[model samples]
Target: MLRRGNEGKKPLKEKIILHYDILFKSHGDDSFDTPTFWEEFFLLKAHPDYIEKKFESFVAKDLIQMKDRLNFLFEKCLEYIQCDQPVRVINALQTMSCLFRGIHSVEVGDHGFDKINLLVGFDMAETSMQVLLRCLTAGLTNDHYNTTIKAVILQLLLVIATGTDNISQNTFVEYLMTNEELYDTLLELLTDPVARSRLGNDTVLLLALMVNYRKYEGVNPFVMRLSVLDDELALSCLGSVISSAFASFNKQFVSKQEESKSSGLFSTITNMVGSMFIGDSDEQKQMIKSNEAILLALYEAIHLNRNFISVLTHSHTDATLVGTPPHTPGGTDDESVPSQPATPTPESFVDASTTRNVLSTFLQYTSVVMQDTKLKRNISSTKLCFIILTCITEDQFANSFIHDENMSFQVCIHKMPMRHRKVKAIVEKPGAPLACWLLDLTVEFIVSHMMKDLPFSQHMRCLGIIHRLMCHEKKCQIRLSYNWRELWTALINLIKFILSNESAIFGRWKKGIFALFTLVINIFNMFITFGDTFLPTPTSYDELYYEIIRLHQVFHSLENFVLRHNANPEYKDVSSRLASSMVNVLAIVRHFNPKIEQYMKDNNMASLTEEEVLEIVKSNYDDLTLKLQHSLDHFERYSERPKETHFFTELVRSISEQYRKTMVFDNIDLQDFMHF
Candidate 1:
């Protein structure tokens, strides 16, 4: 026999080894009976040449023991995050490059997730992120790697951590801050739109991690306290912060979504950047020494910096800053669609408009709690404690992140009518008003995202939201002069549908019923409004018409939401009266035009043929649904089922019956009250 000198393998491409190693480690200690998506994912498709040498002998089924495989696969990532390895900076890029081309499903899969969290979690290893920082700075400057290569590498790291959350709070970011190279490398990615485009959920999570991670100057952990005057750096940093925030939504949170209970991260970025606009107000009538040109450049930079624009425009930002960022031109483009838009845009921008539209639509089902019933019952029955708690907690959480507490508190009050005037309440003082008001807003957001498909969908959540808000703050309603009873009643009404997954109170589709139903009802917790006024009995035909109205209301609501949240006061017109009017008109329309609906169905118009309708619905749904699509709801502690919402039930039942029976006046008789 020949000498056995050739059997041993030579030094392999670092990435190839990394790919195999990560896959091997991620495979875990489990077994697979059949072929797994693992090999077809990381190695075989990624480095087919290397597969023959390393994994060729391993059966595809053998790849199932994910922990072992993944441990080997992501060993590099684990090492890099902990700042371990021969050349962590180089290895980090190599690991990322390999991950970019390979399937990211490993990290997203059940077993893969556990491994990554364990590896990348706080202090998984001893190495520092400083190496990664150096690697990035040096990598970008090298002629060998272009922007695309950098993108691929960066995206790869992102792929590994897609839905795994709180990744920002880890120490990896802290280590990187001490290392200028990596931080600068990230800055480049944030500043360059072309490069940032490649960053998706993974990038978002990484940025979140970076923002929350401690920055090291000498010995202490650092914060991203940005200055308004530092436009060049601020612009890109702002973009990165926004990108990171929005990216948090980019993951496929099919099961339970991981939401930050504490608005800590969201508040951090918003308030820090918000300091720039500290004095640009009508009431205060103050402006920093910074001149006009600087403002103009800031506007252009934010606009050109797509990531920043999308982030700052998200619903999480303070409502005052929601509109166009101070000096931007022509306001937000996404805020222009009216309801039933027929055409919808892609979900590249999860801006403020998207969030507002979602919330506004959900509020339609709200009923007046009746000055009679608010807080009338016990702790559980009243659901007051829960509502108050959510608000107080949200305010506390958001405030903790605000560097200038007074400014944030001012904004919290500004959302109210003459909020600055300040009134006394349970929590005490002007700042307390914001906490109360914020609870209202938060509950409003929850109700806005209700759905009929999930049974007592919106109804359950609405009650839950309200209850949470009322938990710690009892006198919150004192802040609003309007009839809070009706509003609270409406919330209970929405919650009813969420609790019971009955037939869509609106209607069911004739074709692709399941899929369409999922898209319309299950996929989205959209609101439903019926009749111009009064109630309709539940009937099949009525259900269909009601569904149409629901679609319409949702559309208008979305359009308004976008405008309202975008800092455009125009969208905030959906007052209780306005909502009531729309409901009345919808009822009358259903009462009179039930026949047209049948005719449209005969002519195929019943299917909502207009692409714009789908667009608006999808866009609005995407905006809010993204939050739900993640399992954020799971984190919320539901206290108890809300009191019966006769108002919502009566109204929904009224539409169902009237439309089914081809009767109208009961739902909307225009003789006494003019038709809307």
Candidate 2:
């Protein structure tokens, strides 16, 4: 057996000599033991240089001394990989995978250029390219190898493509460009559902990394390949990546620590260390980080691949005509006159299951992010989610998904200040349309960040989404007519909250505030246009009228702020849009002037003129600010409190007791220890 750090008590030089001698002898033996060979290969793969683990010599000198031996081992590994023995090939692939990982590590660290030359001296990049091509040609197509072997071969190629330095990656890409068969086979293997399902996340991640690499220059091969990918295949890949991302979040969010069955102190310490290391392992952290890369791949595909978007927007087509008669209009059936077939009516559609699945996943992910304090800081994923929404919703058919009524989204918003303050949960009803849930979540997300003094461009994107939805009168009518109360309340409160806080108002805030008013006015104008259809009942008429009056009052309050910044060239564009939207509202009010006068008189609700409305807002501004501060502080109470863990406290106390027994402390140290 190969030894690490001279476990068998042999001299370092002697051990190195014996290690090579044994490997060569094993290669010669016809009855080769695969597991034994793997164990020995693993030792060499783990520490290629003899002195790396022991740190007995300077790293550069050790690498220089071991260069020839390392070269010999690589040659042997290549030989084994090309041989007829399947098990031996698999082991060799694993060794190469580990070696490439080490190369990537060297490339990532400081002084990587020099060390990379030493690790993979001359022509190693070319050899890696050849190996990848050979494996793809033989293993991917041959029935001799099972799924596991094919997976290992794919993994080896992935490691070479991703983990190696620029030279190795460029070499592989050049090979792919020239070798059409290899490139085609690789794509076929990746797109195969059976293979992908068996291959798991590594396969998905490898595809994502390859696609995502186009952000760099000289990625024409990948870009060209992405363009040629079948639309269904690309959509499938995107759906898989999104589902994987959601699963990553769900795994962390849904998991809870289990109660320990043992109570011994040693067991406790062991479990604590295991939890610190194994539970929250590097693998878990890597999985979490991969979500960004995966989402980026989806983003790049949506942006770069036109076929992907086409498939996403229109999933399938119906080729048959709806009503093609057996004969011409003037001919009898017995005559059987031949007529040209009616053109197929193509209706825009997407996979409803896929769309619903995506919406539901986002709902759950956003809910978890809001409810879990630990997850609130994950803004990158959240922003990515919104940007993806913005990109897909640009299409009218896709935008109409917000009004999908087949599935309902429900999530519980937890109250902040759990211990001291009593706050009721915001329980969403099960029957509300999906649009209502999305709007509520978006508003809450904006407010949550505003409270934390963190504003982002995604907030603008959120507003743009709502604005786009309102641009279509049919969408606006549905949003208003169904669950009108909640929708109106959310929009009004958001506008009021923004107006109340002048301290947090910046350039973006000005744009956001005006843009919000523009959206509200457009909705108001549409409500009046469709009032007969939307407000058939008298009570509905009263509700909408009251809301319009309240909104008019709000518009009065915002008039001065708009005028103050009207000519500020910075907000000139949004200010003009707001002005035009308000004009539409004025036209609507002009048409209904007599009804407005009679309604106010009948309800005894005096009309507040612009001047009076502004005065009232000024007087109530302080109270509005106070209420906003209270809400922010209420959440802060939960976040600001120090988290107390009994196990951690006891563990620290135990460590302190042991330290105190071993080392006598002076008064200063003793006092500090006591406090700790």
Candidate 3:
């Protein structure tokens, strides 16, 4: 039996040394023959104090003194990994984790000197590669081990892969490239919730690391795998993992809320009083770290997987809604209309599809992250979240934003580190599409950064998402048409915010403003060219009138800014494009100005006020100087503009591409993008 505390009143160092001496003296070269050696050595190594404290504090010299013994133990671990006994394999794997962590903690010599020396002295790189491959092949291919043993094996492999150098990692990755059985095993574990639970996040982390291999020397095996695997299964597995992480975070948040709503007034007061003195609890911080880890895993998965978005869209089939009038331009059927449900019912509305569930979870977690002051400022987490969102919006699917479920959340817009304004909770209308809710949140998020002097790349990411969403994807376009009023309102607010802030258009924010202008112009061009195709609601003309007037005013102001800032050569292209965009929009505005004027006169309405009329009159193209017209084009070419990729994204892509070309993953400091 294992001894409890105080049964052996000896110093841990002394116990370890004495036990080692006894084992060596008794068994010599035959130590593997004795069960006592395995049991006692594992007991000492597995001791909480030893594993946590002693191993962590061990230096290079300390390891050097026990180099021979460490090598022996490592060799034994390799043997035990390949052994038939499951208990032996588990114990060996655990022991290997402890030893590898200790070796990885060598902080004595200059920089990576100690780590390299230790790895070389123990011959860990080559031996670990062999053992790792063998374990994966054996554990996955046959019934030689159970789930527990397989999980332990992967745990050990993670430690090795994390601590070892490139050669070992490359070897393991190369093996996985062609090893179909191992790949299938990983996929099975990802899809099987029970198996995933048993394996924990280790499997997910392992696959994430594998997929992150961006060697462009040849075909990327993981990307190749994406082409071969079932799209639905791939999306379902990844989406489930992401959802589970967010669910855990939501549970904690909900629990905190529930604690405030205790059974009675006294309990509520007690909880409130306790909360005043307490900071973020340990559990919440742990969940934050867990969330960061899961987000990083997802970042790696999507960053490296080529078909991720396609798989995301493929998870849901195209279906239409009943009671929705068919969208026809000029009273003719439009081919751009996607298929819909013939009869809309509660059952039809409950699209518990994989893609919808994943996006819903994203929106839910985003609300939570924005509300929490600490998480709101977590640049890495926030950036990763937006990057994922940007990828999600790259493709449009059927009923992309329509959901029966309610999505109500609050966003706290912070003007400073400690000072914030809690915007009113955005409660969705009974049948409001998810697009409106998402737009509300996004607009609030962008508006929050308008006055703050911070990096705007993440804000640009938000714009990119919206830009892609507004693309001519039929399903998304048709659905958004119904919510055009809400869409126009949100977009106008964003345009007003961007243009009115002089600082936003001047220096660092200049490029983002240019991109924003391009996106807005694209969206504007779409509506102008296709407005007739949408079903004409009773308020369509009125909505279009006000929006066109708003656009006319905004663009006129933008044109005035361009003419005033003509001294800077750097602003030439954007100024020219801005002028071109204005020319296109103003022509449309001129055509509608008289119609709106007539409607207001006939209805005796205040809709087309004198101030709005003056704004439209000033928007005439003939008012521009001849020199400006000579420099500008009458029409904006609707060519395929390259998607707005971030500096951070471009940096990652370049690094990955270079690594692929040279078979070397460069040491780049991506701390800005990495949370964990």
Candidate 4:
């Protein structure tokens, strides 16, 4: 017998086998696992790290003389896994994970894998499967090191169920459906926390692989059932898997090739979102908010699925944010200052009634503008903004949505006081039924969120728009004698409420604002065209008379806010680069007349129709060439021509076009439009 040196009493897993093999030839009737010393020695083999490479020569000697010591080890695993000790049964899963690692890194080819696979399939009972599920589940919450092992086993099973290259895929797929116990075992693993966290997003990655392999089913009910799970972790896993299935699928996999599974992922996600709150209990809700692992998983799911993302992000009617902050705008009251409101602004020329009515009209018109889907908005931004804006203005506009009180279709008619002292009302009709209701709900949500605890940038962007509209000449109506200083003062004070206190918008919110602002700027151009015009081009301006008051109010508001921020040590330079440039445009807007009103009046041009007058104005209007150039020169001294860049960009783009123009008209779908 070859005597390998015994260092720290190595397990006779090899030695006992070697002794048995030698006896099988030279001697006879030898078995192992003696009560104390040998059992203790075998226990040491449980931890392979203790057996150093210094003993490698001994390991080779033992294997050469012994009969497959590793195969003998796995036989012990099968025997003890279902025995008296359930706690030690978990060790089998760890050993299995390690075994797979050994097979991948240690085994060379099909021969090694076949040996490994044969070991894995060693006739396990239903109890064994359940125990493995429980072990995987428990391991998820176990210490970090244990989680690494459990994850490997789960990945192996997932791949075994789906992958093309794996021999286990065909058998596992059939077993998943017909083999009820097997399917339940897989389900139990999914509900396990440690396994899920380990898998993270790879479950989706695997599903993508499944679809690509043409081994996928159409509208799987098991996936559907899992999606409806009340547990956030399970739901999140389901959602990620669903989104991945959708994304993983491409034009390559069609009905002709793989029996078109078109709505499987979409239906799964939609149903999940619709029922996210249904039957979800207190424990589960708390579990969702506090669990960082689960929250990240849920966010990933929400991020990937378009329909699910829409419901979560938009704050619409049916789906609302659960733990939203309270709404407080730091706003002054409307004339009647409650104990809470510090001091209200002093009145200018326009009364509160007229101002409110004007705002109401603006809201209604804005609702119409928002709900106009004829502009071909094929994506999320178009839908989200239009939906949100409509919902916000729903209370203000009667036509766009059915009022809760009457549930009747009614036009929101605002009385405009004509020069002759006669009042004429302007009415905008409602859009389609579904669109109007959805939009109205979204509007209400936005207004509610706007008033609530939100980031300051939200207030700054939204309120800035509102303040600009309020101070429009048609609404503000400040007389020529009225000091521009007081108008500036009124506008400035309001901005203080908006950017008052908060974290700045520097990331996604900033980018989203830029996108929204793009729409707003286009809308502003439309609004400007609809206003007083002496244009050669329809989009051109009346200039000197209309006050261009929206831009003026915004300018004043920004300047006041910036100066205030700079004054406060905490807030200095925090107004953002976006705020400063707004002031520059406001400063120079005074120079643009398009065609000087006095010069045109001296030439008896007041009688000319606006369209005819537009031609002369277009030829004469050198807003970019002369006035903006002059403003840019002055701007360089103070703010380094911040506004000039945007001003010139617009000025050059607009002025070069042909002067022949019509008013920026309200285009509506008469087929869908319901008038009151």
lDDT of each: 0.32, 0.48, 0.51, 0.32
lDDT of 4 by residue, 17-54 (tens): 34323322312433443444334333322332222221
Cα distance off (Å), candidate 3, residue 588: 6.0
lDDT of 1 by residue, 148-244 (tens): 3344355443433232223232233334456545544555555544334333222333443343332222332222322112445545444433323
Give the C-alpha lDDT of model 3.
Answer: 0.51
Candidate with best TM-score: 3
Residue-by-residue lDDT tens digits, candidate 3, 3-109: 67896686466565555444223235545447677655543423323453555656667667656666666667667767664445555667666666566556545
lDDT of residue 667 for candidate 2: 16
Candidate 2 global lDDT: 0.48
User: Which candidate, 2 or 4, would have the higher TM-score against the true structure?
Assistant: 2
RMSD of each: 25.8, 18.1, 13.2, 25.4
Model 4 vs. true fold: TM: 0.29
Candidate 4: worst 10 consecutive residues by lDDT?
314-323
lDDT of 2 by residue, 1-676 (tens): 8556756784555543355344333134432235565445533322233322222322445445555444555666676777775545665666555454444443233544444444455657456556657766677655555455666677666655554323223333344454455555555554554444444445554455454332244555665777677757646645554554554454344332222223357635654443312124444444444455455555556655655654433221111111222322112222222233355332222222333344445455554444322332235455556666566555555555556565454443322222323333234455544566666666556444444242435556666555555444243454333545555655655656666675576444657667656755555555544544534354554455455455665655556567777899988888876776565444433334445566568768788564443333334323221111111101111110133233223322332222222221111111211211
Angstrom error of the Cα, residue 647, model 2: value is: 40
- What's each prediction's TM-score? 0.29, 0.61, 0.67, 0.29
